[model samples]
Target: MHFLRYQWEPYLSYGQLFEFEKNKVVYHQGEAGRGIYYLKNGEIKVTLLSDKGDERIINMVPPGMLFGEHGIHGEPYLTSGTTTCPSLVYYFSDDVIATICRKHPEAAGIYTDSLIYKFRTLAEIIAHLDSPVEQQMAFYLLKLVQENGNASMNQTAFAKYIGTSRITVNKIIQKWKQKGYIELHKREIIIMNFDKIRAIASNPHMD
Candidate 1:
């Protein structure tokens, strides 16, 4: 991914930096995009709202991930993005991005890999809808620990990502702790055993 460092620089003409407070809205569903975004710091919630006023947690975007650009060809955004915490993001204008793609072909590959990774994750979440809630929670936590690490996260944030309550998250943590899979300090969760955590996550039980 070191090549990504270079790909972002030459396209500076297409993007600018933006900052937001926690819970700030980045974009709305059905809204026109000024351009796609590259997350630099903090976390973001990507969600879909229903006509009936329901919402679902699609995913959380951390640094080095691309958000928006769902419909690069004049399509409206399908989901709304909001900052889960104080965040810094990079905005790339559509026109400038197009120009960069024309000038630099390698960028296309990087962008495609980012997009495909998101798509694959979404597919996994869809598959989880039918999974036992406990397994879903377990898988979500394991992935987060892998991504952001237990070092920087807390129970509340973990619950949010799994679409559960903090109390429930704590109970799951307790279970894993007794099993010697994780160690929960004041605000951080230290994964004690990755293989055991992965095994727990792979279980289908909803407990």
Candidate 2:
């Protein structure tokens, strides 16, 4: 869920801005996607409810990115989004999108690309759903590091992202620490050996 926001920021002048407090629900899974959202500031955790009723944080939308895009074609949202902290957001209603497309034809291609990105993301998640916990953790940890330079989240939150418990997450973090694969600094998990972590992410090598 990273995007080059500057490309669409000017056009969003036609959209409405909203402010949300920490932990507020932005949108719920299974609900109609009214329009897409662009994060102007703050963090939103985009989580999906698993078949077994567990919440898995799929992506963390940082400032200057769009989310709630799965709402294309009036379809229901495949995931739920909530504010990770007090933040500023923009709500681009369906009408707003069409209006922008009419005036700025290039914007249409970006929207199409967003849909493709969403599909590819869901496919990747499906492929990893049945993997072992460690494999799953490595996968997301690598993803986070790639997205934000480091995993800027606590173990408990990381557990939720991996659809596991905090204790289990802690155990793996400890194991990685023992191997000098990562270091816990405040809330961030800094990867020391990107190759090793990337290797584990690609295959179930942690066992």
Candidate 3:
């Protein structure tokens, strides 16, 4: 959900603000999460570190979204958050959230919605986990385009996000470009045909 319709900004007034530089590690995985975070500006990438020491990009938090919700209420963070660019973020500790909820009961509902969104993200991850690389790539491409109008991504980041090699991502992107499914430029991908991408994203003929 976009930040405007989500209506969680007012509640963030009680949060502590922090600035982050590009590529900064906001929080590490398995750490006791002090609180949830709201992105006031720039971008944050949430990732999971596998036992094999690979970093898998899971969620990209843009401006005006709540992230790190999975780590609230004394739970350890399930993943790590790092800034993809310079960022302004608001941190809300459990006590702070409790105070807001007590003063404004509606805040609780927003938290619930945020958790629901988190669950949806997790479901998407699981759904794509076993899919072929092309399908996985298409699904995320379509989803990002639908969410942000166009996807600002490089092949390397896309490869890391989808757990593949950069060369593999480049090949698929080139094929899609030839088919007019997308227009690929440096660090950006513009969809030429959403329906066609959506079709391939759902098509699973691989053996």
Candidate 4:
């Protein structure tokens, strides 16, 4: 999805700036949407809570992206958000956002575009749910590369993101390492052979 490049920070002077450490909860699912969040730096994970009280990672908000946007329409938040790393976020109340949109007008278009981008991403995720794990992993790794320039998630988190076990993710990583497709460091996986990885990612029947 294309990231919108609107100058949101300057307009957010009325908003509050907050610093969050890694793993801090930004908002909980089912909570009244108090405001929207603009990520100035670091990553945030959006998770959905199932009826059974299980949590599933729904999306990752990259730096410069917005989260908790449902509040702008007076809707309760559908998902919980948490910081994946130390982060700086600007929180804009619904009234402030509405006022800004009313005054600037163009800001409304930017918000609409951001919502469109998010829906498109959600559609893609839904479409890929039944695909092979290998293909899903490839798409996920590519997504990570686009967002952070490397696979920044550890095996457990990656497994949760991909709906697999940590052991399975570790085995897959080991296989990729043996094939010289990736290099696993302490907490990151570097793509060593992009073409080969791309090939695997594109081929649904690849073993």
lDDT of 2 by residue, 117-167 (tens): 767777887788888888899888888776655689988898888777999
Error of 2 at 201 (Å): 0.9
Write model 1 residue lDDT over 1-207, tens digit each, in one string.
233323455565567889999999888888865678877788878876757775656677767677876746656887788997899888877776777789898777777876676677778777776665567766876766655544446777666556668898788788889978778788777878877766657874422
The candidate that achieves the highest TM-score relative to the unseen native structure: 3
Of candidates 3 and 2, the better by TM-score: 3
Structural similarity to truth (TM-score) of each candidate: 0.82, 0.93, 0.94, 0.89
CA lDDT scores, all candidates in order: 0.72, 0.84, 0.84, 0.79
Residue 165 shift from truth in candidate 3, angstroms = 0.3
Ranking by TM-score: 3, 2, 4, 1
Candidate 4 similarity to native, TM-score: 0.89
- Candidate 2, residue 148: Cα displacement in angstroms equals 2.5
Off by over 4 Å in 3: 3-6, 204-207
Candidate 3: the clashing residue pairs are none
Pick the winner on lDDT between candidates 1 and 2. 2
| Residues 1-207 of candidate 3: C-alpha lDDT, one tens digit per residue | 664333778887799999999999888899988888888998988898888999888877778788888778788998899999999989999999889999999888888888788778878987788889999998888777666566888888999889999999999999889988889677889988877888888894531
RMSD of each: 3.0, 1.6, 1.9, 2.0
TM-score of 2: 0.93
